[model samples]
Target chain A: MTQVAQAMRDKTAVCGVGLTLGNFQDKSALALSVEAYDLALEDAGLERKDVDGLIQLSFGNDYDRFLEAVGTDVRYAYQGWSHGRFIAPMLQQAAMVVASGMAKAVAIVHGRRRRAFGQLADTEMWRQGLGPHGESPAYGAMGPVFGAAIAAQRYFHMYGGSGDDLAPIAMAFRKHAQLNPLACRTSPMTREDYLNSRWIVEPLRLFDCCQNNDGGACLIITSAERARDCKKPPVYISGMQGVHAGPQFHNLTLPGLGVAQQEVFNYRPQKEDLYAYQMAGVTQKDIDFLITYDAFSPLVLFGLERFGFCGPGEAKDFIKDGRIELGGELPINTSGGLLSEGHVVGWNLFIEAIRQLRHECGPRQVKDAEVCQYGSFLGETVIFRR
Target chain B: MEPSYKVVEEKTGRYLPVIYPEELPFWEGARKHEIILQRCNSCAKSWYPIGPACPHCFSMSFKWDRMSGRGTLHNYVVFHKPWTKWFESKVPYAVVQIQLEEGPRLTTNFLDCAVKDIKIGMPVEAVFEDITSDITLVQFRPGKK
Candidate 1:
């Protein structure tokens, strides 16, 4: 595993970062993808001819439309995230295509008009005849918040968790959002505000949920040799891996089976995150900073544990006052993750990891940061280094 | 007198389950006040959300057996917000997970109880709720102590 990981290490690099449609309105999903793709090419200092591969990172995104809009033919074409979960899996695939000499430059882009279309509830996807269990119609199981709320309740019941323990995780990202101009919610939030926020679902306030925003984020990955000649300093991909800890993610069928299903989600935090880190050969201490996918607040708590930063139930204790804040022992979601920052799915975290690796985040940057890890329970991690 | 077990189709509302061909038998049994689960003939393992074959034995053949209708509350959540207009009246209702004695878990709602009274590890018994003439959604209520 280490040898395989070593083979990919520093072999490919992300040369360009393009974010075009965040917090905007009246923009179509395809338009956002094209805009982000255009900016990525500009940032990489490459044109249509430079991209031999293209990968769509979201559902319903027209690869044909993008191909026509760009007017460029590629030797290789692939679609990532047919389920449209996030970009980690897609990015990992793009890197592999680049590493295997199948493509010189792979352009990966994701676009969403979720807020513009008033589709804030992500669970609605299950209702659109995709999954076997149609949530709202069959059972009143509505959105991601409902599932997250149940998970939080179980965490509280099993681990003795409290809202107070998870408050810092929410506020820390809000603090980081204050420094991020592109973040949707930049206003500073106090602990009182978090507690006072209206409950969307029990144990989860409105603040606990991710903010809906129309956006697109893209990245250009190429061979290390090609990236060295690009405009910006190359940020190396040390390791990347994707692991699914459980069966499917529906509530009606699987329900709380995730807690009981050891094969899908590892009971031990060390084992869960290590499944990815073992390939990269990076430890928790080696990760200077982390960007846990914060679609929900408990996600940070869960991510902290899964990444081996703390014990199974120790995340509630691990995320103490100012511990994950800037200049602390370890900073997380410095770009105001899904909760406070706009939800580009996980793309913002991917872009932020690259920015932090490049030392470009003005105030929110992790000082002297060398290695950064981005991951979530759906189980994918990519360690980026300067 | 006991309530009728017939599932009237016209009475079903917007939240009724859309029964596919494979799920027909489960609903048919629910309409008769019986809880049925698919048990593999080879491995003798039972599973929920019925699949085409046994995950344990990978056998295409299985049996639909009646359950004792008793289980333990694994976990639950009380929805403060409604998902759709149909659920608007059901706000603040607790959605519960029951770990059946047959080794399968079911997502259901509790009847005849307050949301606050629900507890993990508490005993629960399956109860059938006929929403339509052809559809009966299986639910759970507090089991006899």
Candidate 2:
């Protein structure tokens, strides 16, 4: 590990987390965000004035608007693009701020309404570099699902699997969601139901795609020393890696899947790709549980492969027979992940990691969970320790 | 020959490509039933999504070289859910990514083929569709074996 990465290890920890999922039509996005922020401050046992930093994404409101609503000031603040891929980077930024003394405590917050004013269909897909998720509107290849669908097709073609291979992922998360009261889709989903689900895009069924709903989430990061005195046990930010991008790193697809301009090949994580584990001074075996960005079921497969949890095409077989379930080896997304928990642009996944480390998750908790990871297909990661 | 999908006479609600200033030549090439891409003079490679520099060698020196209009279907998906009115009637249509002989993949629709018949590695040839007086799109169809 680099000296800089070594110094940053476990210096900052998540002191508090707040989340609100499901429809909130009566409340605006800003109001929902403010409520979550208030909950986080209370949960951290810190007054509004105690928080010296603020970070948010561009969905609900601007940073100034949020500060005005909360009536608190901070020394460090930033706003990022409102995409699930950026969530890990936002958390990493907060950790860096606290570690570097830019802020005593930083809160990364988000609130979004489904199909709100800045809808992807209305605007984002029209952006210059193709829709954020490779949405080619001209060909009616619209929505974020198109990106996952195309990647899955390529994966299946290269690795020899079909949409049926994705059933285990959907069924596994749904089982976990049944244990989570806050999960949006908690109903039992059998294999039959998965097969019967209508297709959204070929190789991706309705069940394979995450549901959109109004939600808000927040997580507070502070120096490890200060976090010790907070209301809950500090979930130390042990290691982190930023989102990888380029011709090879497509938005939703893993590197080497050859989506768009990417080169076609089987992707395997070299030493550099697993830098987060190195920074954390641990390996994949040390991870008690994992929480990944599962905007779609195929993303889980990609996430596993990207993080070296399994080989390039082996994730299909690795996720089978209750292996990723609560009682199985390397349980993933125990709080039902974005696939079932609800997508707060992936903030919920981070919150889930924090809760697992704190042992706050009752029925859905992994037994004696000590280490957790929030990894994604785009290669961004955050390794947290209890 | 008439395209299988209905092209509405009223073109108001149709979702057309937002042609960027840099991509005018590619669109103009489509109007003339040809595929044109930026090929690097130094590296001798082509790229997609219309960029200014060569992604392969970082060479700014390049030419808008005309392609053979032939490629292989590298990837595809069928959209069962339509996002717009024009696509509502065209449900279950195949959107493909064709890897050209010169090597960059392009996102486009497939013509003269059913969604089920579309396969990866299938040879496909470019076909032009003049959607409007000012806009012509580059689509693909099954090519010789």
TM-score of chain B of each: 0.88, 0.90
In candidate 2, position A50 carries an lDDT of 86
Model 2 lDDT per residue over B32-73, tens place: 888988999999998887888887899999999999989999
Query: Which is the leading candidate under lDDT?
Result: 2
lDDT of 1: 0.74
Query: What does the lDDT read for residue A51 in candidate 1?
Result: 90
Q: Give the DockQ (2 decimals) of all models.
A: 0.41, 0.60
Chain A TM-score, each candidate: 0.90, 0.98
lDDT of every model, 2 decimals: 0.74, 0.89
Instruction: Give the number of the best model, judged by TM-score.
Output: 2
lDDT of 2 by residue, A263-367 (tens): 888999999888898899989999999899898999999999999999989999999999999999989998888899888888988998998889988988899
- In candidate 2, the residue pairs with backbone N, CA or C atoms under 3 Å apart (3 or more residues apart, or in different chains) clash, namely none
| Model 1: per-residue Cα lDDT over B74-109, one tens digit each | 878777777666667988887777788888777778
lDDT tens digits by residue: candidate 1, A1-386: 65776788878999998884355567788788888888888888888799999888544456777888879899888765433244677888888999999999998877888644433344343332223222433556556676667677777777796655678888999999899888888887998988888877777888888877788878999988999999888888888877453354342221222533212233454364455566667777898988887878887776676566776677787788688888888899998888877877677788889988889999888999999988665556888888
